[model samples]
Target: MKQSGNSLIEFLLVTVVILAVTASILALAGQTDKKRVNEELSDLATLTATAERALGMPQGHYEGLPGKLIDEKLVPAKMVDSAGHLQSRWGPVNLVPIDVGAKRLAGYSITYTNVPSPACPLLVKGGPKDKRSIRVDSVEVGSFGNINASALAQACSKATVSITFEHHLNEPGKRSL
Candidate 1:
């Protein structure tokens, strides 16, 4: 008499198909998560820079701040990640006022630091005309604040990847280079 269920070969074929489909789904899910994290990082960088510039305008200096930027409302109040860390999808956002100008009135340089895990390098693309486009994994950090064209180029090299929003205390509502 014939067997009542699937043959050995048929059962093995079905199992293999199921495993392959499951693996494909998992791979896609991971990619989607990475994309979401990258987008969140970009948004956080832009928002923090803009808020910091606004905060410094009235003071006429962007350096020697007294408190964490989050307290100043420069960063949105969001629930901490699963790890309970005050950070974006990447990691902690460190804003360092690089160079304070004379009397702190010439507009200071602010560096937005997002230390991504080595597995994921920070990647961002600027406007078409904007020269600050990151195309590689590592880059030399450059100076900001009323920087010269050459300095800007070096700071915004293809190997470098970061977003900088400039605001001069002298010019209200004016976006910086």
Candidate 2:
């Protein structure tokens, strides 16, 4: 009579195959996340610089103000990402209204935004104390390319790509909730 030794060997082989498949899946997932993180970092750098640069020039009540940095030259009306999310091609990364505390017409506040602001919140009114405050939405990068459309359009989308922004209020004491 044949022993059941063959059954044990078959079981070992199946286990090995399962482990290999699992390992492969985990590796792929990791690679994808890495790629996304890198992309988010790089993209954020570009957007932040661009937005900051735009803050340099003085703007009018209705007319758009100039940027602090114009790498490509001239503010664009809008900029679209690979997924079609847009930034103002010509305007600031994002816009904020004149605040009451502002020393000038507007103070561009890019420090608070770690990454570039999103394409939405067309206009953000400044705080009562500061006139020159523009709040660019935070940009988040996820492993997946399809960030929710609303998030892409709005700064608060909460994409996987997270950013920490820093800001120094011109009139912190005057700020209201």
Candidate 3:
């Protein structure tokens, strides 16, 4: 009877230790994810600044901006994989020109696809504030002004999401909203 009681206690202790270790590992993983998300946001900010500089140049347009950025080595090396394709934390990063009107390419849009739902709010909240518009899965959640947190949260409630950051040129060599 005494040996059985000791064995039971040992089993309970080992189970408790296992549970604690699992909890610690989960917490550490959460922290790591947060750190990675912050890194991605920083990279996005750098890319946006680079695009703005390109827009301010003599051409003053977004035509072929993605290729230009890649060819000129303006994009951060970390964002590009071995195949030279831009990648975000969750998936591919696409940079394309935005046609304002009359076949005029006046701006650029950065789209990050296959984004996990939890990262949606973080991306929107931490994204560049000077963007002309922000969209989640083809729905415009914010534009030319402060983004509504509630709207963003609602829009981002999905298994996977796509976020687009659109930057527009108000005039030649000038950025607006």
Candidate 4:
């Protein structure tokens, strides 16, 4: 019996199926990456917001802790959730993640919320630090997981993200979303 080669339509169908599977896999990976980036941003924002809130705490406010900041030996890490609740006492609040780090945790960085910031580089008529407003630069947040500062920056860069906090104080846009 003469052998018959596979039809063109059959080959095309197989190719299409293979391409579809590959595309789906790629799309899933991309989505996962995006989720990671967003999570990182959210964590960073939370960490910073907590710090700002701490500073805003009424001067006379008192808590059971000897020092409101936590760390008895030093200033504690100002940490809070998105709704404005303190989380950590003296560690990377959420940005670097509690479980992160090998020799150290990955993807972390601290930026100090600038007081009377220079002005939003992207906004117009952004005033000066005293009476003006601008986005905050890098803040001295605690550490990444248990890692140092530089390592955190390296981990977060993969998502084209830079951890930072908003200096929302006595103004309309103080808290982050």
Candidate 5:
């Protein structure tokens, strides 16, 4: 009886350790995935801003939607996927063109919504939370043109140019892991 009790306790101990280690590894993987997705989102935002600046530079005024600009060759096609959609690890990014009125161009803002995979665990907070969309309302686009500071300020005040991403969180491949 004494020997059987000891064997059972030992088995339980080993099982607990294995479970703990597996949990830690999965958590780490999730963190890494979140970081990668965030970086991709930032890159897309930067590219959009730069492309808009390029379009606005020649005319001393930047106006029109990103898609239109791309069609005009002002923005590169490489900036978006073959489907003409900007994509991140989380999913497709959509550009919401804020009309650049007769006013100057200020900065813009960004927001993201992620639909996590059922196969994966819940993501951590303060990054891209699972199944939730977060908006970074104010992203300032500085004066890329020769416009005056006052005009820039006015544009900033009234500008509605922004971007958003919404998609399912696809799982990384074995090589990525």
Candidate 6:
């Protein structure tokens, strides 16, 4: 009877330790994901500002700005892979020109593909808010200033998602999209 009681206690203690370890691991993973998301957002903002500075005037179009950024070494070295493609933790990062009207470029768009569902909301809500439009999986959720939480939740419910950030030019003499 004494040995049995000791065995039971030992079993319970081991189970408790396992549960605690699992919980700790989960918490750590969540923190890591959050940190990565924040880092990606910061990188995106830096890329936007750098591109704007390098491109000067809109010139009515910003086609191929992604390649230009890569060529000029404007992108962070860590984000660019060996093949010179811009990559994020989830997937590829693409930058394209946003044409307003009559081939006039009003702004640019940054699209992150293959984004995990869990990170979708974080990416959307954490992006630069001024003069930016956000879309999830090709569905327009909201602008930076007026995001709908419900809409975001619905749109982000997927195994993989794509988030696009349309950054309109807010400079002098440039029209905002």
**TM-scores for every predicted model:** 0.49, 0.42, 0.89, 0.36, 0.47, 0.88
Per-residue accuracy of model 5 over 122-153 as CA lDDT, tens digit each: 11122222211222224322211122334334
1-177: candidate 3 lDDT, tens digit per residue: 999999999999999999999999999988877887899999999888888786645554787767777878898888887887888878999988878776478778999999888788888888987777899988888876478778788889999999999877774444453
Ranking by lDDT: 3, 6, 1, 5, 2, 4
- Residue 158 of candidate 2: its Cα lDDT? 39
Best candidate (score: lDDT): 3
47-68 per-residue lDDT for model 4 (tens digits) = 3344334533433112222233
- lDDT tens digits by residue: candidate 2, 1-177: 145788888889999999999999999976765554454344445554444444433332212322323334443323443433334322223333233344444333332232323322211211112222233344441111223334435654433222223222233443311
lDDT of 5 at 57: 45
Candidate 1 segments whose C-alpha is farther than 4 A from its true place? 1-8, 58-60, 64-68, 79-86, 100-122, 126-138, 141-177
Q: Each prediction's Cα lDDT score?
A: 0.44, 0.37, 0.83, 0.34, 0.42, 0.81
Prediction RMSDs, each to the true structure: 7.6, 11.4, 2.6, 13.9, 14.4, 2.6
Off by over 4 Å in 6: 56-60, 170-177
In model 3, pairs of residues that clash are: none
lDDT of 2: 0.37
lDDT of 6 at 85: 92
Candidate 4: C-alpha RMSD to true structure equals 13.9
* Candidates, ranked, TM-score: 3, 6, 1, 5, 2, 4
Candidate 1 worst ten-residue window by lDDT? 127-136
Q: Which scores greater on lDDT, model 4 or model 6?
A: 6
Q: Could you tell me the lDDT of residue 120 within candidate 2?
A: 26
Q: 2 or 3, which is superior by TM-score?
A: 3
**Model 1 lDDT on a 0 to 1 scale:** 0.44
Two-way lDDT contest, 3 vs 4, winner: 3
lDDT score, residue 71, model 5? 69
